[model samples]
Target: MATMQECPRSPEAKLGMRVEDLWDIQEAQLSPTEKLNACFESIPVSAFPLPSSNQEVEIKSDATLSEAVKILAHHNILSAPVVNVDAPEDASWIDRYIGIVEFAGIVVWILHQSEPASPKSPSTPTSATAIAAAANGNTFALELEALGLGSASTTSGNFFEDLTSSELYKNTKVRDISGTFRWAPFLALERSNSFLTMLLLLSKYKMKSVPVVDLGAGRIDNIITQAAVIHMVAECAGLQWFENWGTKKLSDVGLPLVSPKQIIKVYEDEPVLQAFKVMRKEKVGGVPVIKSGSNTPVGNISLRDVQFLLTAPEIYHDYRAITVKDFMTAVSSYLEKNKTAFSMSCEFVTCKMDCTVKELIQLLDREKIHRVYVVDNNGDLEGLISLRDIISRLVDEPRGYFGDFFDGVLPLPANSRV
Candidate 1:
């Protein structure tokens, strides 16, 4: 049988190579030939399959907000697909992929819809009626239904025609951390700044992340986070102080830094399926997309985006050819149009350099963004804050699993170093 060393590097090459060719290769050094069949059998395409979306409840874009909420609540689904029944001629009718409507979005909308039209005087009753009166004449169920269906149902049954005529895509200021670029500003120690101080800032502002830049260097250095600080403190106290005494620097106790090479970029015009395949194969959560000419990041496509897409298979098939440009919300469009990014008003938060790691973690937890960006004073891109980075710093190795294994292990002879 072929030994481990006899395995071929390429399956295709193995299929074409003769048994004599394998036996003749000195590097393989196969003493037995029976194992060759076993290695070759493992090379089929079944070894890899495309990643797929997890089964979750789906809702039509035109469904009433009340209906959407009910479905989501019942199914425990966090988001749903919004479909445009009447898509363009080039588009497939069944392919009605619209953006997602998340539970958070629904909650925010409900809060706004339920608010009273006028402020109640001290004498106003605190009962349901008083509360309903204050809601500026907006009804939660009605508004939900209205927004759910788009405008066509109101004027006529031709919802797609009306939607198409009036810019089916609405620009809204969805919260994006990339916007709040700032340079490294000195945060005074007198501000009672500590890891906790920074943590509070992040949480209060609902930021996904904050950057730490060295003022003197004029470049981003390292990010600090609540998770990192906590883990470092725990490791110092638990390991170095009591067990392993010589390890120094946070890096020794934390996960290795992820180099930029680890990050993958995709074009905005690529098919969603292609992006989906890459992410699944790589086991990555998100990818940055750059415009055709600009190296600057235009937007991000994430797992959540795929989840929204899967809710409507028809839309997915139709837009399989669509690029990121077809759906991406531009920064300029966001600032000028009074439109929310992609028609949603998500909060955008950022922090200046010199912010502590503790602060960044708080922002991540509160904002619920998977990643955050660090920027310069002019809002130029600097670095990024990611959940993996935080977790790596925070996770601890269990104690005593290899106890005494390293105690007094013999040092190698000076001249006999292997």
Candidate 2:
């Protein structure tokens, strides 16, 4: 584990010399990974591609959860900033936005709304035959519009309509769930902040996305995501520094940070709701679906995959009874039928332990996936690697590189997920 290092003030500290200068002088003495880190540190947030507009998909604080889902889907975003409608035009960006409401957070909310008063397992058998039969009439594929790949069928979604507490999603406002566990604190990066600072926040701090706020203009100029960072790293494929580090095998980099016993996964026989609840509790974006009574990974389920469940008609017919097997079967069936609409995410990316870092990066970038599972010769999942995990290994925050830069930021809870 890396700790924040303290650098005592020297006469040079009073000279207003930024760490980037010190880094440049020491660049020759640095390792491949450190050189790559310094390369990014030299860049500024302004260098990133700016969005068309900050107001592109701004959701009102008063908007219903259902309305929020529609807006996110329409814009093909996993999350959007929830701004305070009553904030004065002169209010600071901090006061203007409540927090980013994400697809994952909303999935947890749906699971909460569907919770039964008396907990009991459904009688439906989770066998393959049963699940296959249930998926027959389904026309929905793993709609990944949240990534702007394409549009999903505007099917008459029955997720909200099927819920007994239908009004929960229909009437509940986005602000009402501010107290939920998944509600992340609204933290933004200034355009002048170093790329290293943003990298630390995304990896070490576990922030899925960091909103880049332009204080001078008082608008969110861009939202830097882990995916964006991964893409940036991918673009450095031929660079000497990235090539030196990327050639190392996964084992050398200590990836799949967790052991097989530590992997959090769900069985195919378990209810689809249970799989989501497990993801919510674990604070993970996704989990591999294991075959019933075995360790074989049959499929992958993620929070973003909720679009298929919510938008698909047959999938949500029995929210409580739908098994992970049924869900995976439905996704496979739908994607096979509507191949173009289905993104590469419909299939999980897997690699052996001997896979090189560059190979892993290629898998993630080419597939546009946030994670990849490491499997054995027999194809049984041994561990997992996420975009966050990959970036965390690439750089180590230097001592005093950022002196009290994030001091006044809101304290994130131990279990906060974004």
Scored by CA lDDT, what does every candidate get? 0.38, 0.69
* RMSD, every candidate, angstroms: 26.2, 11.1
**Candidate 2: residue pairs that collide:** none
TM-score of every model? 0.33, 0.78
| Span of ten consecutive residues with least summed lDDT in model 2 | 140-149
199 in model 2: Cα distance from truth in Å?
0.9
Error of 1 at 124 (Å): 74
- The numbered model that scores best in TM-score is 2
What are the per-residue Cα lDDT tens digits for candidate 1 across 27-140? Answer: 444322223322322233222111122243445555654455456545544554444445553453223333345544432332333223355642333333344334323342
